[model samples]
Target: MERTLLIKNMVCDRCKTTVLELLKTEGFKVQSVALGEVVVKDASKKDDIRLKTALQAIGFELIQEEADVLVEKMKLALIKQMDKGDADFILSKIAEDLGKHYSFLSKTFSQLEGITLEKYLINLKIEKVKEYIQLKQLNFSEIAYSLNYKSSSHLAKQFKSITGMSMTAYKKLQESDRKGLDKIV
Candidate 1:
């Protein structure tokens, strides 16, 4: 039989690659490894413990509880939306996609993560904005639109609020400060 492993902190292509390599090196028949989960054949509780130990050594985690699984799912959904340039907090849409009631998801997310989904999303967006700024490809107006913000001014207000500096000031700064998606939460 196969077992599914829900993981936390697998947020990027590089992360997926790392997990895939680890599974192969550790002699697990990994059926698949995705952003936030892995399916492996012939897994057991002992395998879980060993995998957990190996992943933890590399700053990742094996999620064991249902609530934690849901939280990781929620994070994956938000990051996907952001990457697709469809960032929006449509509770109904998020709920429908996740197959849960909006209220329940919100409450459970808050209880498990100690922060509302909206707040978490805003933080993610701000981080993305920093990344875009450093890349220097898109203008502020373009980024604002890509992120689904109302306007460049709106994005600037949020950027300043989150980072304590103007967008132009940020651009001029010597340091290209940014954080990885997995490191966000």
Candidate 2:
């Protein structure tokens, strides 16, 4: 039998690769792995328990609730938007792609995650800004424009607000204070 499992904290391609390898190592006939989900063939009850234990050991989670799954999907959708540098597309993209209303998504994410969706998104973007700053390839203006901020100042304000320091200060202390994408929430 083929089984699909919804996972939490799968925020990037590396996460997919990690999960795929782990599933294979556990002797499941892995079918596919994507952010927040995986499919495996010939799984049994014992397999479920073993897989859960393995996943937890690596900072991943086996999500069971339908609402929790939806929240994870919303998080992945937002992460995709951030990767594409299309910051303003959150509302429409999530609504159309997930087939849910913005209000519903926002409410559900807040209720499940203990933070508003908007704050969660801001955290994601701030982390990206930190990454770009660490790379030192893009100036503040370019970074702000690429992430779709109104202006570098606007981006700076948000960055400082979220990170508790100005971009310049962050640049000075650039010793990898960045959080893993999965730890954003």
Candidate 3:
């Protein structure tokens, strides 16, 4: 039998790799590992207990509540939208993709996270801006376009507003200033 486990704090490819490796090393037949969930084969109750413990030991947690699961799903969806660089009707798109109403998702996200989903997304976008600036491959205009901002000026304004400093200033700062995606909220 296959069992699917909802995981928390899995926000990047490295996290996925870590979870997959841990599962394999712990003698579980891993079916797949995604950002927020994993599927394993023929796992008994003892295996699940061990798996939960192991995952928690490494900063990941098994999501037991359905509401938490939905929130995680929404977060993953928002991340995917950001990666796509198409912010047009993004909330609706996410709701459609997740098969949930936008109002419910928005409400649940704010209630559970104590922060509006839009605010969380803005934070994520700011972090992405920091990443792009650090890469030095794209100019301000390109970064703005890629991130769905109206213009470079707009992007710079939001960046400054969120970071308390200009983009150029942030670029001058150490890379350690950037926050991890999972740590955005």
Candidate 4:
């Protein structure tokens, strides 16, 4: 039977890779590893304990909840779509793809994570913008467009609101001085 495991702090591609490697080394048949989940083809209680320990050792915790797992999946999917720099996505599209009401998911996420889904998405987008700015490869307008902002001014306004500084000021600051998303909160 395939079992889905909830993992905390498993937020990025690197985490997915690490989890997959750990599972493989431990002899579990991992079907897939995503942002906050691991699908195993056949798993037992012993395997579960070992997997939990392995993940915990690397600063991740295994959770137990189908709803929570689905919530995490939703968050990850949104993040991935945003990261792709696609402008086609909106809340309704996400809700439809997840087969759940946007209001319900947003409410559940806010209640559980103490942050609205929109806020989380904004944070992720801002982080990506910061990365692009640091790279010095893309101009503000391009970054804004790539991120699906209505315009450069709109992106700047939102960026300033969130980071308390203009994009120009941020770009001038030393990269080493920049704060990460986790540090922002």
Candidate 5:
């Protein structure tokens, strides 16, 4: 049987590559590897223990619980949206896209992740905003627009709230405050 494994910390292209390589090296056929998941085409209970041990050795984890599986699904869906530059959309819409009601997603996400969905989404947006700032390609207004904020001021307010610094302050800093999309929350 084809089985899907939810993997924690599989956050970036490099992470995916590592997981894919590790799976291949360990004799598992990786049908696909995305940000937080992998699908294998073969079937076996034995593969589970071996794969779990191998994955853990490499700083990755297999998620087996049903709720955590759902949580990872929610996180992956959000990350996918952000990576596509479509994060300017609403949470309810994202929930709808994931085929779950906004209320259930919000409650479950908060209960398990210890933070509200809105807060998590804002954190993700702020990280992307930092990336744009570091890139220096887009001005604040343009970046704000690109990220779907109502106005630059609104974006600044939220940004300052999260980072404890204004855009100007962040710009003057010696290093980037950006985090990988998978590490936002």
Candidate 6:
């Protein structure tokens, strides 16, 4: 039977390619792969175990969820959105695209992930913001607008609240010492 495996650290295209290769090498036909998922044509328990082990060896994880699949799907969707879109995407737009009530999605996400959807979005956004800042291509006004903040002031406030430093202060810090997504919460 076809099975969906939720994977961790499958965040980028390179990660997706590695997963596809792993599944193909292991003799499973990969139907599709996105941020946190690998859909297989047919997989048994033995295959699942092997796949889990292979993924772990590569520093990835296979997350199995029956009850909270939708919640996990939502999180993956949000991550994909952040990865692809400009920083200023509207939450209302995301809610509409996901085809669920925003409040319900937010509550379910918080319950499952231990963080509110807004906070999660902020975390993702801040990461993207940091990336943009490091690139040194965009000015603060442009970064704020690209990220969909109301203004530079608004972006600055949120950035400070989350990172405990002004954007300028953060930019001045050594690039090697910048916080990663895991360090955010």
lDDT of each: 0.88, 0.87, 0.86, 0.78, 0.85, 0.77
The positional error of residue 173 in candidate 2, measured at the CA in angstroms, is 0.8
- Give the candidates in order of lDDT, highest first: 1, 2, 3, 5, 4, 6
The C-alpha TM-scores of every prediction are: 0.95, 0.93, 0.92, 0.86, 0.92, 0.83
Candidate 2 clash pair list? none
Q: Write candidate 3's Cα lDDT for 1-185 as tens digits.
A: 99898898998889999999998999989898888989989988777778889999999988878889988988887777767765554776778888889899899999999998898988998998888898999988889888888889998999989889999888888754888777877
Question: Of 1 and 2, which scores higher on TM-score?
Answer: 1
Query: Please, what are the lDDT tens digits per residue for candidate 1 over residues 98-135?
Result: 88898888899999888898888888999999889999
Off-target runs (Cα >4 Å) in candidate 1 are none
Candidate closer to the true structure by lDDT (higher is better), 4 or 6: 4
Model 6 RMSD to the real structure? 2.6
lDDT of 5 by residue, 72-129 (tens): 8777777778788896567787677778888998999899889988899889889889
The clash count for each model shown is 0, 0, 0, 0, 0, 3
The TM-score leader among the candidates is: 1
Shift of residue 56 alpha carbon in model 3, Å: 1.4
lDDT measured at residue 146 in model 4 versus the true structure, 0 to 100: 91
Q: Report the C-alpha displacement of residue 20, candidate 3, in angstroms.
A: 1.0
What overall lDDT, based on C-alpha atoms, would model 3 receive against the true structure?
A: 0.86
Candidate 2 Cα errors over 4 Å, as ranges: none
Cα misplacement distance, residue 124 of candidate 5 (Å): 0.3
lDDT of 6 by residue, 54-170 (tens): 999987877776426556666566666777765555666656876878787777778877888778878888888888889999999998888888899999999999888899998
Q: Choose 3 or 6, whichever is better by lDDT.
A: 3
